[model samples]
Target: MEHKDNRYTISGTDIEEVKRKNGQSGMSYNEAIEWMAKTTGGRGTAIYSDTNMEEVKKQNQSVQDYNKNKA
Candidate 1:
């Protein structure tokens, strides 16, 4: 999902709620984005690909692995 700047206007409370409900610190960026898209309804053409998502997932996994090893 390619998010346009100023395209979605979700409230802080709503964002917090989503985070709280979706796993808080464990929530991935893509998960939060998915929630926002669902909450706000979809519009405009998708100008992005899943490649960005794959990168995010990779980074997230890296962090998770680092934390696990640290612990």
Candidate 2:
């Protein structure tokens, strides 16, 4: 699993993977969170209980945006 500021990708199923999967899928942050939860069977830290998802999402967004341009 690859860890990001805002989330973790399990088995190559992170935001970028999803974004690429559906072609401009426009998946919401919450949807992504839920998707991760379902996919990992609660193994993903990004969607684990006691997590402040909104905060993680905000923090991660900045990093993701930066990476987008940097990459």
What TM-score would you give candidate 1 relative to the actual structure? Answer: 0.31
Candidate 2: where are CA atoms >4 Å away?
1-48
lDDT agreement with native, every candidate = 0.60, 0.69
In the range 1-71, model 2's lDDT, one tens digit per residue, is: 44564443554446756657777766677776777776765665454456677998999999999999999
lDDT of 2 at 32: 69
lDDT of 1 at 48: 26
Off by over 4 Å in 1: 1-51
RMSD of each: 19.0, 22.6
- Per-residue lDDT of 10 in model 2: 51
lDDT of 1 by residue, 1-71 (tens): 54454434443235555656777466587765666565664453133223366788999999999999999
Each candidate structure's count of clashing pairs = 0, 0
How many Å off is the CA of 21 in candidate 2? 53
